[model samples]
Target: MADYPILAVVGHPNKGKSSVVSALTQNDQVHISPLSGTTRVAQHFSLKLDGETVFELVDTPGFQRAAKCLAWLRVEELPADQRPARVAEFVEQFRSSGQFFDEVELLKPIVAGAGIIYVVDGSLPYSPEYETEMEILRWTGRPRLALINPIGGDAYVAQWQQALNQYFSLVKQFDPLHASFDQHLQLLRSFGELDSRPGRIFDQAIEQLEQYRRQKLEQAARILVENLYRLLTYQQSSSRLEQAAREQLPELLPAEISRFNQHLNWLERDGQQQLEALFLYHRLESDLARLEVRQSELMDESQWTLWGLEKKQLVLVSAAAGATLGLLADAGLGGSSLFAGAIGGGVLGGVSGWLGLDWFKQQLPAWLQFSAEQHLLGPVKDPNFAFVILGRALSHARAMLARSHADRERLTIHQAGDHFMQSLEMKVQIRLLKQCKQLVRQGPQGQAAEQLRAWIYQQLTA
Candidate 1:
C-alpha cells in the first residue's frame, strides 16, 4: 500500500458526490447546487489521516450512460496520444447532448490508480444502468467500496444494497447531510482493507488516520472558538470605548469615537481573513467574498437601504472606518496619545470584521436607531455605570489631545503627560487581558488554546 491512499469519489449523476466530498473534507471547497452536472472536472483535496498524510479525496464528476452510438464513437476515436483531451471533449459532448444528465468520462482518475468510492441514490429504485456502470467500474480493477447516499426515503435501501453487494467488496449507507467523524473513520477503515500487502503498514496507516481525524477536528474546534471570542471581545471593548467617548467629551467624542470604532472594525475584519485562511484553506479573494455574503445577511434591508451599501460599498466602509479610526486614535483625540493602543485596536477590529465579525455584530447593538420621538441615537439607548466609566476615559483622551496640540514642546508636558499616558495604557491592557482570559476559558483544554493565551499576553505586554 502506498503511504498516501488516493480515494476517488464517483457515482451516477446527481448522486450527491460533491456533498460526500464536502462532508469528508469539512470544507466548502466544492460548489454544490441543486442543479445536476455542477462538477465538470475532477477536484483533489487532501485530508490528514492518523498523524500522517494518508488520505486524498478526488471528487470526480457524476457518471452517466453514454448513448450507444456515442459510446461506440468514443471507443473508436479516442486516440492513445490524445486520450485525456479526447475524453474531456466526449464528456462535454455528452453533457450538451441532453441524452443524459451526467457524463462518466471524468472517471479517468479512478481508472488510473485511485480506489473507487462509488456512490448511488438509495431513494430511487436500483436501475440496470447503475449495474452497467458498476460493471464498467470493475473493469478498472481498482479496489472499490459502495456508498449508498440517501437523497430520499429509505424504503428502497434493501434493493440498493443487494445491487451494491454484487459489485463492491464493502457496502456502507451514509447520509452525507449528517455525516459524523466516526462515519468518516469507518469509510477510511474500509479503504484500508483494500491493500493486501500485509504488515505493520496497515496498522500504521489506520493509526495515522485516526490521529489525523482527531487533530483536524480539534483544529476546527479551536479555530471556531478563537474566531467567536475575537469577534465578541473586540466588539464589546470597542463599542464601550466609543460610547464612553460620546458621553464624556460631547464636543469631540462623537467624531473621535466614530473614528476609533471604524479603525477597530478594520482590524477585526483583517483578523477574520487570516482566521479563514488558516482554518478553511481559502484564498484571500474567496474568503473576502464569503465575508461579504455573511455581512449582507447580517445587514437588514433597511440598514442596507440607509447605507446604500453594495458589496463594494461595505468593503470600502469597513476599510475607511478602520483607517480613519486608527489614525485618530494614534494622534490622540480623547486624552492619552498612545499610538500602540490605537494601532493594535484598529488592526484587531478591522481583521475580525473582515474575517466574519459582521455576523457577530448583528447579535450586538444595531448600528443605527431612532427613538420614539424620531431622534437618531447611538449604540446605547440608556447611560449605565459602564457607560460612565467609558465616558470618563474618553474625556481624558480628549483633554490629552488638546494639551498635545497646545504644547509644541514634547518633554515640557513632563509628569502630567506621563501620568495620563501610563493610566490610559494600563486601562487598555487590563481590558484586553480580561477579554483574552475569558476567551481562553471558553476554549477546549489543549495546547493550542494555551499557546494562543500566551500569545495574547505577549501582545499585551509588548
Candidate 2:
C-alpha cells in the first residue's frame, strides 16, 4: 500500500477539486459543481491498466472549519514530531461528534499515509485566510503538493504560486478543463518526485499510460476504416422497392434515401460510440452533420467541398487515377457526343477516380439497381463520397483526442479546421483513391482494408 501512492486532494469550497481528480484519474463520473460543498465524503478513484492499479486519487470534501480545527491542535505545546499523533488523536476524538466531520474525513487518508494535493483557485487573489488549512496539512507530516487551478482565468496565478510555494513541497498551475495529454504525463512525472519509495511505481505507471494511449489510437483507426467500408458499400432492400412501379420510384426514391441516410448515420454513430468507449468516454455526443444523398447527388458545396476535396482537386485526382476524358466531361465539362464512353470509363476507372454527377442523374438505375432480381437501394456511387467519410472521421478523432475527460460540454465536430485529406500529397491521395476502389469491390476483409487502417493509424499518430 505504501508503494501504491494514494493522493488526498483537499481544497476550499467551490474550487476545482473534483475537476482535478477527474482529469488526473481520467474518470468523468466524478461529481463536479460550481456550488460549494458538493463533495461531502471522500471518494477513491484509481487509474488502472490491465487491472493493475497505477495510482489512486482521493476526492475529499473541502475544509469547513479549518481555523477552529487548528485552534484545537494548538491547545497544547507540541514538538513537530508529536504534531502528527495529535492530529490523529483529534480524528479519533471527533470521529462521531459531527463537529469536524469534513476535517476528519479529509485527514483520514493523510493520517493513513496518503500524500496531500492542495487545490486553490488561481483566478482569485491569494490570501492568508487559507493558511490555517495549509498549516494543519503540514502538521500531518505527509509529502504535500499544491495545485493552482485557474478555473476562470489565470489573472492571479503568480499571486497564488508565491503563497503556495511557501506551504507545499511542490507547486504547479493546472487547468483540468483544457490540459493536454502531454501535460498529464508531465504531472504524473512530478508525482514521482514527491517521494523516493513510490517514485519507481509512478515511472512504471507513466510508461504504461503512454503505451495504453497508443493502443487506443490504433484501435480507433481500425474502427474508422471498417466503418468507412460499411458506409461506402452499404445496401438496403425492402418489399416496397420491389413492389413499386418504375414510374413510382421517383416518389418512392426520396423516402428510401431517407431510410438509407438514417442507417448510414446509425453506422457512423456506432463507430463513434466505439471510439468514445475506447477512450473511456461513456457519455460523449458528437454534433456532426447527418449523411445524406438527395436525388442521386452528393451534398451541396458547403458540405461536400469543405469536408471532402474541392471539385477541382476531385477532377485532378480522378484524371491522375486514369479516368477517361469523357468522365471529365460529366463533371461540368462541355463535350460533344463523340466521347460517349465517359460514363462507362468512369465506372471502370472506379468511384474515387471521377466526378460523374451528370452521369449520376442520368443513371439513377445504377444506384437503385435490380440485382439478383431484387431491387436494392444503395452503396452510394459518388467518387468523392469516400473522401467525405474519411475527412469526417479524422475530424471526429482529433476532437475526441484533444478533449479532457473533465469537460462536460457536448463534443462538437466543427468543420472550421482544415480538412486533413485535402492536404495530403497527390501520390498518397492517389493511393487512398485506389484503396477506396478495393474496398468497394471487395468489402472490408481484404488487403485494402489493412492498408487503409495503416494509413489512418499514421495520420492519427502524426
Candidate 3:
C-alpha cells in the first residue's frame, strides 16, 4: 500500500542507463544490448528500500537531438487535436532510427516529478553536446544527481567532474556492478536532498524498504523448510515398503523410487543452502514440527501405518504384480523368454505380495498385523484380489516416479522442492478439513471448526 518514490535514469545514448537501472533493481528489466538506442521507451521496476516498498527505478530511452527536432516539427505543424497522434508517430519513427543526439528533449517526465539520475561516461572528456543536454534537463527544475560511469580508463575522471560541476548540484563516481549495499543506500540518501535541504520522507521510506526485504527473505526461508518436510515425510512413508520389498526382488529391479526420493532430498537441501547463503535464517526445525502436526491430522491412522515395514511388504507384492503386467505389456514369448518371464514373474509376485501387505497394514490395527500377514502369505488366499490391488499400486507408483522425474527435469531442484512442499501443505490442509467435518458431525466445536476449516481451505485452495 506504500507509495514508492520514482527515480528516473536519463542521459545520452550508450551512457550505461540500463546498467545503472539493472544494478539498482537487481533485475534485468531494461534490455542491455550493445547496440545504441536499445531502450526505446520508459521501463519501470520496483525494489524494496530498507524494509519498505519505497523505491522504483524508471529506465528511459536514450536522448536523440535529431529525433527531438522531427518531433518538434510535427508538434508545430499538426493541429492541436491531432498533435497527440503526430507526436506518437514521430516518437515511433525516432525509436526505429539507429542514431540519436544527446538532449534534454526526452527528459520532460523526470523533470516534472521524479528524482533525476544522470549518467555520463567518465572515460572521455566531457563533450559540449552533453553540456547542452544538461542545460536542457536543468530547465525542468528537478533535484538532480550526476553519476560518472567509469569506463576504459581513470585518466579523465578529474575533467569529467569539473565539467559535471558546471551544471549539476552533486556528482559522484559510481560503478553500478560493483557498488555495495551501503554505498547504494548512501546514494539514495543523497537523492533525498532537495534545494540544499534534507528530505525526511525518504528516511522512513528506507526503513520500510529494509523491513520488506527482510520479510521476503523470511518467506523464502519458510518455503525452503516446507520443502524439506515434504521430502522427508514422503520418503519415510514410501521407504517402509520399498526397502523391504527391494531386498527380496531381482538385483536389476529398478531402484527408480529410491532414486526419486534421493533426488527430492537433494533439491530440499539445495533450496535450504540457497536461503542460508543469502544470510536468511533457516527455520527448518520449527517448520518441520508444524508440518508433522498438520500431517498427523491429515492422514488417517491407516494411512499413517503405511510408513512402516508392514506396509512395505504390501508394496513389494504390488511391485511383483506390476512386473508381471509389465511383461505382458510386451507379448511374444519363446521357451527361454517364458523361463525368464517365470523367474521375473516370481520376483514380481513377491513384490505384489509386499505391496498388498503395505496396503493392509495401513487399514488394519497393529493387533491385526499378524493375522493379515498370515492371510497374505497363508496357504489359502485370494490370488485375484491380490493381483488387482498390487497392480493398481504398482501403476500409481510408476506414474508418481515418472511425474517426479519430469518435475526434476523441468524445474530447478530448489523450485521442485518448493512445489513438493506446497503439495504436502495442501494435503495437510485437506486432512484438517476432514477433521473439522468429523467434529461438526459431533456438534459444538465441530461447527466453528468447520467454518474456520472452510475459510482456510478456500483461502489456500483458491
TM-score of each: 0.50, 0.87, 0.48
Off by over 4 Å in 1: 31-33, 48-53, 66-107, 199-206, 213-248, 262-272, 281-462
The better candidate by TM-score, 1 or 3, is: 1
Clashes of 1: 45
Summarize candidate 3's per-residue lDDT along 74-110 as a digit string, tens digits: 4455555554344344445555454342333254346
Residue-level lDDT tens digits of model 1 in 1-462 = 356677788877788887787776655566666788778778887655433465677887776454452454357654455544554454456655555434443455664567789888888898777666675566556788889887886778899898889898898898776655567777777777875644544466557756664454345335434543443434222333344432443344345345544544454455444544433434334434454343332212332222222333333332333343342233222221121222234433322222222222233213222223222222221111121222222222222222211111221112233332124343353343333344444643545455544543332223
Model 3 bad stretches (over 4 Å): 1-4, 48-53, 66-105, 151-155, 195-199, 228-254, 269-462
lDDT of 2 at 167: 86
What stretches of model 2 exceed 4 Å from their correct place? Answer: 286-301, 322-364, 441-445
Question: For residues 379-420, what per-residue lDDT tens digits would candidate 2 score against the true structure?
Answer: 765555687778877888888888888888777665566767
After the best TM-score superposition of candidate 3, give how far the Cα of residue 126 lies from its true spot, in angstroms.
Answer: 3.4
